[model samples]
Target chain A: MMETIGIWVAAFLTLSMFSFLYKDNPFYKFAEHLFVGASMGYFIPYTFFNVFIPYAYNPLFLRHNYWLIIPFVIGLGYWFRFSNNLGWLSRYPIAFSMGIVGMGVPMSIHAQILVQMRTMMLPLTNINLILIFIGTVSILLYFFFSKAHEGLYGKFTSVGIWFMMVGFGASFGYTVMARLSLLIGRLQFLLGDWLGLIK
Target chain B: MNFSDYIQKIDRRYIFIILAIAVILPLLFPLGLPTFTTPPVLSLYKHIDEAAGTDDRAVFMDFAQSPSTLPELYPMDLAILRHCFLRDIKVLTISYYPQGAAIMQMAISEVKEDFPDVKQDVDYCNFGFRNFALRVPITLGMGDNIAEAVETNAAGRRLENLPIMEKLKNYDNIQVCMEISGAAPGIIYINYARARYGVDVAIGVTAVSAADNYPYLQTGQLVGLLGGLKGAAEYEELVETFANNDIPYSEKKAQNLSWRNQQYELSKVPYKFKQARIGMDAQAVAHVLIIIFIIIGNIGYFIEKRQDKNKYVK
Candidate 1:
């Protein structure tokens, strides 16, 4: 009985969301706003109970890792952004996070940068690997303003543009598939679960 | 006005209605069109199979997507979980998104219902919903020691005590970490876990975001990928074709690594597992509608340009 009720509620919301295609209306607005509002409601308490209490409160109070109090206080300083006078206090947390992020730069350089470059230096006998090598170089060359794209360089730059178009085409195709899948999912709920139209 | 002008001026709402019918019809009557398995999907399936006999070897699945991305990513998770469970491979799951833990529970319970004898805490373990804030540390930490990294399961049970974690000292024991997400959260595993410890990483992402991981797969950073609904459908087919859900635990150890692919019977698959393929049928019809529109629109556009050029010449 509860499952049936749940399906009806979901079906109503799905129809409400689809109403936007007709034009701007109250149903669409209600569905859109409810989605955003519910997300916030779910996130706030979830963060507190799962993240704050476990990673923060428990570590300082229960585990007695007193040093955590320093970062904890800095984290609280973020709430000061709400107050005009004490807004400057928010900089502490921002600065602390910035410092931590800065420390991660070296890590990113090694993994994302250096390692990726190593993979490119391959025996490009295969068509796939050969295209990857050429594609990377040509795309980089297209961005080089030092040499005018007027001769052989122009041909290569044009090839780069072709490569980019193919990449963009693939991305756009995938986007369409993703959107359709989301629609199919909702339709399945309505038709299969609610109306008994499909199994 | 000419045909070109009429074509150009057609209302978009008509197109929407046509698309609606095209997609809706497929749902009402499934075409059961075959889902072709790609290499990336095959690679991940084979990687999971590598851990078939071993109790120590495991696969870490990070549910890094929200309910918003559920349609595409959820089926992949279910198919993957089913694969692992069928092959007698140990499973480890963690959720980095807010809704992830709940999603993980839902998928597990649904899949678990089919395999009642597959015990938890032994065959599988889930250390649920650590917020994205802890993502970096938790990912890197798990490389050295998993129990130390996660600390506890969703049930507040220690990972150290779980039978599943016995031989799992680090990433070495794990086959690959599959980040099932809408976005590229798999990059985290690649950068931190794989880059640092040489762990293999696989990604299952929403179709739109699948393009982002292509470069990684080409460069060998990502071991394999499952892209959107098509990906999920392919995985379900692979599981149906290869995993052979009825194969006993005793027989799984003797299974060959070079298991040949068989024709995936769409009708033979359960309805709960048929969601992705049914969705794919809708996708196929929808694509046909779009393609026809694209071709007509292009012809109209070029003809209009040609007519304008002739007028200017005159």
Candidate 2:
């Protein structure tokens, strides 16, 4: 009986979301608000139990790691943003996080940029490698704002544009597939799981 | 409006209705469209098959997607989990997003239900969500000692005591750290875990992010990738084929092997395991619809342009 009720609730929400395809309606709004409220409700306790208690409270109190209190205090400073008089205090947490991120940027550049460039610099012996190398160089040239694109440079940038268009087209096609997959999921739920219309 | 204009400006509701019918009909009656396994997906399967066998080497599965992407990502998650379980590969599952904990639980339960004797905390364990901010530290810490890095499993039980943790102590035991996410954590895993500890990494990302992963794959940073629903379907096909042809399940207990043996006999793939494959039927039809609409719209546009040119000539 509970399973049946759950199915009905899910089916209702699924149809409510689908109703937006026609136009804006109260059903869609209700479902949207419900989703947000439910997500927040789920997120709060999950964070407290899973993250805060395990990483923060347990370390500070149970383990007696007093140094952990420094970051905890900085975390608490974020609450001060709600107060006009104490709003400046929030900058401590912001600055602390920004500093940590600043430290991480160099490492990230090494991994994402330098490593990627090293990979691209490999011997372009194959057609696939040659195309990849050419595409990367031409695309970089296309975005070269300092120099005006003309003659040979213009032709190179034009090739860059073609490569970019092909990339964009592939990405767009994948996006459509992703969206349709989501729809198929909901429909499968409504039909097979809920209505028993499909096997 | 002219005929060309009318054709170009067809009501979106009509298209929606047609698409709904197109998708729904396929679900009701599956077309059984053939799925071709791509090289990236095949590479992932081959790596897992070869690498993760002994207790010393295991698979670290990062379930980083939420409920919103369940349709696209869940099937791939299930396929990978099923593959691991069938091959007797020890798995340590973790969730990066809060909602991922529930998703991980669901996938495990579904797969575990098939193999009743597959013990939890031994065959598999789930160390639930951690703060994304501490991803670097947590990842690095795992290289030193997993039990110390993640103190507890999802159930709040100590990880040190778990039998699975004995062999799964560090990155050396991790054969492949596969991140099954809509937003792939490839860079983080590559930067910290792979670069620091020499761990092999793979990703099962949503199609939207699939194209972006090609560069990483090209650079040999990622072992393999499963992109979107198509990727999921391909992985599922691989699993089904592997189970049927490979793997000596006959030596094992007959009862433990019954579920898999029954599920993959001849050409009768079970619907539960074929979620992504069945969804592909809808995908194929929808792609056709989109292509037809694009062609008609383009033709209508050209016709309208020619008519306007004729008007100017007049």
Q: Candidate 1's residue-wise lDDT over B1-314, tens digit each?
A: 89999998998899889888988899999896766667788778877888897988999999988889988999999999999888888999988776777789899999999899898899999887787767888888888899998877877677899888889978998899999987665878887888788999999999999887776887677888999999998878777766765443222322332332332442366678767888899999988888898899999999999999999999
Q: What local lDDT does model 2 show for residue A178?
A: 93
Write candidate 2's Cα lDDT for A118-195 as tens digits: 989899889988898899999999999999999998999899999999999999999989999999999999899998
What docking grade does candidate 2 earn? medium
Which candidate number maximizes lDDT? 2
- Poorly placed runs, candidate 1 (over 4 Å): A126-128, B246-267
Choose the strongest candidate by DockQ: 2
Question: TM-score of each candidate?
Answer: 0.92, 0.93
lDDT of candidate 2 over B237-278, digit per residue (tens) = 778866534553331322233444444566476788899989
The per-model lDDT (C-alpha) reads 0.83, 0.85
DockQ of predictions, in order shown: 0.66, 0.71
